[model samples]
Target: MSNSNYVLVLFYSRHGSIAEMAKFIARGVNKVTKMDVKIRQVPDVSDTTTIASPAVPDEGAPYCTLEELANCSALAMGSPSYFGSMAAPLKHFIDQTSTLWLTGRLIDKPACGFTSASTMHGGQEQCLHSMMTPLLHHGMVWVGLPYKNKALISTTSGGTPYGASHLANSTNDTTLTEDEKALCEAQGQRIAEMALKLQ
Candidate 1:
């Protein structure tokens, strides 16, 4: 078990692709010393108001709670893009976090974001930007990989300074490129470093 403080890596992955991205980000978070990463995911959402998901996820990362968001030293939020924005499930989850905002539990913490999409131009950057909104509202510091990360310069598949991403093959679950993986690690390390400095 990790005894040191943690950077919570929270995400919602519908097609498994986003989940892979989350793992790569966590890999980056693991690179830091005396600080660990906790991977948590949200449960699925349904359009029918009467239909509800279970409290525990059947697979992938465990479902995240408001306390998870409130307690983490930092965060790396992810989601697959949907119409130039974050997916509804993640949006729904964030909508319920106003209490955290009110208490300013996230203030001054470093935060970052990531995303995946079926197509090369499927608004991945927009999705990343969309996830950044609530973090900004909470007064959390935003982080992204710098150009100094070699992958940012050579990646034709997926990877960006805005965070990290995967171009995503047709199935939308293609394995992340080496570049994408490196950038995810870079973002994690960056957030962890800042979180440590803030301590």
Candidate 2:
């Protein structure tokens, strides 16, 4: 298992905070020797008549494919909180994984979650939980941060043992604090390590 093995950092972002957090996590994944990361994103679903997004996004990571999701050694999912849950586009994409579930393609793989929310108390934990549910159902091992990270104990803003979290503020202008950045990197390292051992 070398850099040939990759962790899929999949996410959906509305205001860019979650996407920004994905970068630190990817940096952490890259810290481990023989490991690499692929960051992917889902498209916004349409409620109007059927319309497809561009083949490639205008910017950021390319859209995630089911093949990529099924084949990755590990997964790190991110989403912005939507009323205490994951945003609907990410959920809609996850719902399409029944075929992978039927074949057990993702079973026993390592998985972790990250989230961004509007306030300190704005359901980041719940958002993490919501992201975890599908991974659990897929039989993927859930990876979480540990309190030993120190930031978990001292953070005034977002940093959680549940995963990595960020407080984006009302205007969505808040940047990730140093504590949150460290935890994101730690989480990426942890998942890459687990994926290596599992391999």
Candidate 3:
């Protein structure tokens, strides 16, 4: 299948909560018949210049390539909060997309963000915004969860108008609350539906 047939679900997770959220979002994308989802991850970044990550990861999703990112029909980006910002690995990967930005390859594509934080007030929304910044610069259409989803109003854990989120607690719990899962799916489904319409 062509890249345009799928929604790219890209994320970075340190303690696994963000990865678990990606799975639920992918489930929502699959709910849209004929639309596919691609789950990819960014490699860990290190301060030492002598060290490098492997070409492929040993577990979970493979590291995303620029080609995969540029060609996707739609995008769902997630990350664990880092001092109210996105994780460095994900930011590092995105920083390399200057080529795509120059080419406007992602222009008009539907996109959304998701995140996980250690606490309810741990800057999940800020992390989501950090993820959306580059996409907006690429001219991608931002897709966000609306108030119409009951989960948004009821979720004490992590649903937001900006995007789906998860409160991982201090233990870094990977498990999502019922509302968080639902909101994740809803965001994915909405992005997929938007992608199809754009096509």
Name the best candidate (by lDDT).
2
Give the per-residue lDDT digits (tens) of candidate 2, residues 85-193: 9988899899999999999999999999999988889999999999999999999999999999998899888888889999887646647889989999999999999
TM-score of model 1 vs. true structure: 0.95
- Stretches of candidate 3 exceeding 4 Å from the true structure: 1-4, 48-51
Comparing 1 and 3 on lDDT, the stronger one? 3
* Candidate 1 backbone collisions, by pair: none
Per-residue lDDT for 21-116 in model 3, tens only? 999999999999879999999998887532257888889998899999988999999999899999888888888999999999999999999998
Worst ten-residue run, lDDT, model 2? 46-55
lDDT of every predicted structure (CA atoms): 0.85, 0.91, 0.91
TM-score for every candidate vs. truth?
0.95, 0.95, 0.95
Comparison by lDDT, 1 against 2, better one: 2
lDDT, model 3, position 169:
75
Q: lDDT by residue for model 1 over 116-153, one digit each (tens)?
A: 88888999999889988888999999898889988899
Query: Clash number for every model?
Result: 0, 1, 0
Q: In candidate 3, how many Å is residue 114 off?
A: 0.5
